[model samples]
Target: MTSSTEPSLYAPREPVFPRRVSGPFRRLKWWIMAVTLGIYYLTPWLRWERGPSLPDQAVLVDLAHRRFYFFWIEIWPHEFYFVAGLLIMAGLGLFLFTSALGRVWCGYACPQTVWTDLFILVERWIEGDRNARVKLWKAKWNLRKWRLRMTKWIVWLLIAMATGGAWVFYFTDAPSLARDLVSFSAHPVAYGTIAVLTATTFVFGGFMREQVCIYMCPWPRIQAAMMDDDTLTVAYRDWRGEPRGKKRDGTTGDCIDCMACVNVCPMGIDIRDGQQMECITCALCIDACDDVMDRIGKPRGLIDYLALSDEPVERAGAAPKPIWKHVLRPRTILYTTLWSLVGVGLLYALFIRSDIGLTVSPVRNPTYVTQSDGSIRNIYDVRLRNQLGEARVFRLSVSSDSLLRIDLQGIPDGSDVTVPADSTHLQRVYVTAGPDDAAASTDVSDLRLWVEDLATGDRASRATTFNGKGN
Candidate 1:
C-alpha cells in the first residue's frame, strides 16, 4: 500500500565495474598503491639495533612497557605531548594538502583508497574487464561463475588477513609475534584484533569499495570547509563540452555522448554531472576522457583538474592562472606555516630534551611527623627514570630557603640511587627539619628535589611542597 509518488529512504547500491585505462594519472595511482602497500607490509620487519637490552624492531608500539620506539627515538608514557604534537602536525598537513589540491590525501595515499585499488586489481584479474564483470554480475549463477567468485574471494581473504597481520606486528616484536602466531601461542587479544581487521578489510575493500568513501568516511563531508575557490579538484569542462553532440555537423560541441567517463568511474558517478561529494578527485575520469578525446581527434582536458576561480578564464577561452598561484595562496600558506612551525618545534624539543627524569610525590596522609628529637619530618616517594643505555648512579639533593635535610631509606649514605637502563625506580625519601629551623615552624615551605646522573653530570629536579607544623 505504498504510494507511487512516495519517496524511498533507502536505495540499493549499484555495482561499479571500472574499466581499465592507462594514462599518466593511472600510472601515478599504480605507483602510489604499490609503494604504500609495500611500506605497510614490510615496515614492521625492518630491524634497528638499539642495544643489548632494548628491542631491535625499528618501529614498535610496546604497550606492555608503555613505550613507543621509532628507529632511534623512544617515547615514554610521561612524554605523551610528543605524540600529541605529531598528531597536530599530521592534521595540519592534511589541511595544507586539502587546501592546495582538494582530497589528494583521500585519492592518492589514503589506506582505504590503496586497499580498494588492490581489491579491484584482483577482481579485474580473476573476472575479465568492466564489460565481462558486468555481464557476469547479471548472469545466472553457474559453475564458471562460482569458480571465478570463489577464486576472487579466496585471494581477497588472503590479502585482508595479511593486512591484519601486518598491523599487529607494529605493536610488538614482529619476529617473536610471528613465531607465536604460527605456533598458536599468541595472546587471544592478538587473534581478536586480526580477525576484526581482516573482516573489515575484506568487506570494505572488496564489497563496499566506494561506499566507504561516499557514506562511511567523514572526510568527504568535512573537505568542503577545507577547500576554497582556488583549490584544484577534478572537474569537467561543461562550457566546452556542452550541447552534447558528436562532430557530425560543424557546429556541435566536443562531447560525443559515449559515456566513457562514466564507464571508468570507480564510484559509478558521471563526472559530467558536475562536482559531487562522491568524487574522490582521483583523476581516473581525467584519464578516461583524455583517451576518448585523443581517439576522436579532439584536444585533451575534457575532464581534468581545475579550480573554480579559473573556470571563468577557461570558459572565456583564455589561459588559466599558474599552478603556483593557486597553491601558494593565503589559506595554503597559512596552513604550511603552521605545519612547519609545529615540525620545527617538535624537532627542537626532541633535541633539547634531557635523558634524566624525576617525579616527586609527597605522602600527605600524615602531613608532618614530629620526631622524638623535636624535628619535623616529611615522607616523599621519588621516582627516577634512567633513559641512558646503561645503569648509572643518580645522586639526590634537596634545596630550600630554610634548612632541610634529605635522606634515602635504603641507601647507606642517603646520597646515591642507581636506576637500571631505560627504566624508572621508586625510592622512599625523608626530608627532616630541625625544631629550631624556620621550615619546621611554618605551615608550608617550598622544596626542590634534584637528581643528578653521576656519570653524565646531567640533572633533573621536581619542585614540591614540604608540609610543616604551624607556629
Candidate 2:
C-alpha cells in the first residue's frame, strides 16, 4: 500500500482591507502616526545656529567633513565610539520596550506599520471600507475598478516619493539639496537612494502590507525571546470566550461569534484562534471586542492585553492582577537600569570630552639633522585639531631639557599659529639643541608638544621624542 502525504508549504495571501475602527487604540494610532511622520519629514528642514562655516541643518551627518551635528552637539570622526554607544542604547531600548509591552513598537511606531496604515486609509477612502472592498476585490474588473485602482496607486506613489525624498535630505544641506533635486542637478547617489526607497515603500506599504510583518520582518521571532509569561501581550480569554456559539435560548458566551475582532484586524488573524505569532499586539481587537460586548450588555475584555501568568488566576474565576504588578518584575527593572546607565554614560562623555587635541609625528627619514655649529635639529610634523566653532590662535611650545628650544619653521619664536575652527591644521616645526646646550641624557630624549588656547588659556599636549647628540 502506498501512503499519500502532501505538504502545502506556502499559501496565497488573502488581501486585508481592515475595517475602519473607532476607539482609544485607533485614536492613539492616529496621534502616533502624526508625530512620527511629522518628525521624519520635517526634521531635515529644521535649522540650527552653528557658525558660518558649519552646515546649519539641525541634525546632519556631514560625511564630507567627517562630522555629525545634532543641534548643539558636534561629533568628530575620532568620536565614533559615541555613535556606537548610541546604537547600543537604541538596541537596549528596543529590548526594554519589548519585554515590557510586546510588539508595541511593531504595531505603533514601526515605519512598516505606519505607512501601511496610511496606505490602507487611502485604500478605504478610494475603494470603500472592508465589506465594500471585499466585494470590489471579487468583482469583475470594470471601468470603476480600474479607475479606483489607478487613483489609489497614484496616491501611494506620491506618498512613497515624499517618504524617500525626505530621507535623502538628511544627508545634505536640506534646502540646497531640495533645490538641486527639483532642478535635476542633485547627486546621482541621492536620486538613486530616493528611487530605491520609494519603490520599497510603495511595494511594501501598498501591496505587501501585513505580509511584511508576518514574513519579512525578524522582530516577531526575536521578540518571543524577550517576552515571558508575565509580559503583556494581546490574547483571548478562552476560559470565558469558549463553550461559545448560539444556543436555542439566544444565550451564548460573550464572544457572540460576531467576528468583529477578525474583521477589523490589519493582520487578519483571529485572536480567538489563540496567541499566534502573527498578532502584532495592536489591541485594536480589544477595542472591537469591547464595543461588541457593550452592545450585548456584557463585561469587556473577552480579548485583551493579557499576561499569560494571569491565566491561572482568571481561569480560577478571579480577576487578573493589575498591569503594573506584572510590568515591574525583576527582569524589566534590570533592563531599565542598564538602559538608563548607558544613557547617563553617553551624556557624561559628551560633556567632559576635549575640544582641542594635538598629535605629533617626528620625521624619521633623516631623524636628526646636525645644524651648522655642532647643534642638533629634529623636524616634527604636528597636527592641531580645533573643535571650537570659531577660529582660534594657539601658542605652540615645548617642554624638554633646559637646552632644547621650539621654533615654528616660518614664524618668530613667540608668534602664534592660527588654526581654523572645527578642523585639523598641520605644521612643520623644528626642535633644536645648540652646540653647548645639547641634551645630556641620550640621542632620543622625551619632550612635550604643548598647545595653549590664546583666547581662553586652555591647554593640551602630546608627548614626543627629541633627537639630539647627547649620546
Candidate 3:
C-alpha cells in the first residue's frame, strides 16, 4: 500500500494559459505558422505534368513501385544515397541553427509548435483569451463549458484528420486516393494510418502541447550540447531588472515584478528564473514584456535574445557584440562548409546520372557449356532498366581483349531488345569463345557487356568474366 505521508513522485499538471500579446515576435510567429502549415496541408495537392507512365503529383513516394517522384526528378531505389545526403544536410542545418540561435527550430518551425499554435488559436476563438480560458477551466461543469469544449475538440479533430489524409496522399495519386477514401474503398492500411495519426495529432496539439516539448521531446536535453556561451537565446536581463518591486523607486530595478513575462509563457515558467530546459525560446515573453515596458515609459528588452558572453559586458554598461560576430564563429563555419560540400556533391551526382542502368549476373550452375562446334559459351542474366517514359529498343554488344562474340537468346543476330517504359527487362545473354582462342580456352576472360538506348543513344556497361572450357 502507498503511504500518503511520503512525497508523491508525480505532480499534477497546472494548465498554462498564455495571454495574447502583440509585438514583432508575435507577428513573426504568426507568419511562420501560416507558411509551415500551408506547405504541409497543400503540398500533396500540387500537380506536375509527368508522362502518362507516372503519377502527376508533384511530390510522391511510390512505395509499391519503389520510386520517389519530385517534379522533374525521379529517384529509384538504387539512388537512395541522394536521400541520405539530404538527411545529412538537414542534420547539419539543424546543428548550425542550434549553435547560432538556440532552439529556434523548436520555437518557430517545428510541426509540434506550428500545430499547437493553431490549436491555441482555435481555443482562443471559441473560449476567449487567456483570462477567459483560466476561468473556464476553473468554473463548475455546465452546458456552456461543455458546448465550448466540444466545439473546439470537433474543430481540432477535423484539422487532425486533414493532416493525416495529406500524409497518405504523398504515397499515391492524391485524387484517386481521396475518392477511394470518400467511398470507403481505400486500403485498410490507409484507414489505420489515418486513424492513428488523427488520434495522436488531436491529443498532442490540443491537450499535451507544452508537456510534449518539455518531457517527451529529446531536443531540450540534446540542445545543451549544441549551445555555448556565445549562443544567442531568449534571456532575462537580471542585472538591469533585478531587486524586484511594485513601485519604480531609486532602489527598485526595472522589473517591477508585474508577472507579465510569466503570464505570457506557454510553458508556465518564469523567464526571470534564468534559462531552463523547458524554454523553447519562442520570444512571446519578449513581446509581452516589451508591451509592458512601452506602457510604463521604460526601455524595451527586459526579456530579449541575448548571449551569455555578453551578460557581464552589458552589466558593466557596455554594448554587446554584433549579431554576425556571434553567428559566424568557427563551429558554425565548419557546419556550413560541410553542408555546402554535401549539397554540391549531390547536385553533381544528380546531373551526371545515366538515363539507363545495366546489371549482369552470371549463371554459374553449369559454369561454361561446350558448344557442338568446339566453342565455349558463358551464360548471363542481364537486367536492362529503362528510365524514360516511353518504350525503347536497346542494342546489346560485347567486347574483350581476347576473341569473343555476344548473342541474345531470343532476338535475331543484330536486332535490339525492346524494354517497356520505366521498367526493367531481364534478358538471357550468351558470350562465346572459339576453340582457337587461347585466353578463353585456358582461363576466365574479362568481358564488357554494353547496352545502348536505340532512341537516345545513351549507353551503360557492366563488366563480367567469361569462363573458359578448361577452367
Candidate 3: C-alpha RMSD after superposition: 1.4
Show model 1 residue runs off by greater than 4 Å.
1-7
* Steric clashes per prediction: 0, 0, 0
Better of 1 and 2 by TM-score: 1
Residue pairs in clash, model 1: none
Give candidate 2's error at residue 105 in angstroms: 0.8
Native-to-model Cα distance after best TM-score fit, residue 240 in candidate 1, in Å: 1.2
For candidate 2, write residues 1-471 as lDDT tens digits. Answer: 233576566688988868888888989999999999999999999999988888889999888878999999988998998999999888888898889888989989999999999999999989999999999999999999999999999999999999999999888899999999999999999999999999999999999989899999999999999998888989998878776774525465566788889999999999998878999988889889899888888898898888989999989989888999889999889988998999999999998887777889999878788877877888899988898889999998889766677789788656489988788998898888877774633577888888899899999989989776655
In the predicted model 3, the residue pairs found to clash are none
Clashing pairs in 2: none
Give the per-residue lDDT digits (tens) of candidate 3, residues 1-471. Answer: 347888877877789988887899999999999888888888889999978987899999999999999889999999999999999999999999999999999999999998998999999999999999999999998999999999999999999999888899999889999999999999999999999999999999999999999889998898899999999999999998989887766898888898989988888999999999999999999999999889988899989999999999999999999999999999999989999999999999999998888899999988999889888889999998888888999999888888788888887566489999989899999888888887557767788998888777888899898888764
Candidate 2 vs candidate 3: the lDDT winner is 3
Measured on C-alpha atoms, candidate 2 has an lDDT of 0.88
For TM-score, the strongest prediction is: 3
Residues 1-471 of candidate 1 have per-residue lDDT tens digits of 346898777888999999998899999999999898999999999999988989999999999999899999999988899999999999999999999999999989999999998999999999999999999999899999999999999999999999999999999999999999999999999999999999999999999999999889999888999999999999989988887886668676788888888988888999899888898888998998999999989999989999999999988989999989999998998999999999999999999988888789999989989999999999999988887778989999999999899899988676999899899999999999999999999999999999888877988898999888988
Give the distance in Å from residue 349's predicted Cα in candidate 1 to where it truly belongs.
Answer: 1.6
Best by lDDT: 1
Order of all candidates by TM-score, from best down to worst?
3, 1, 2
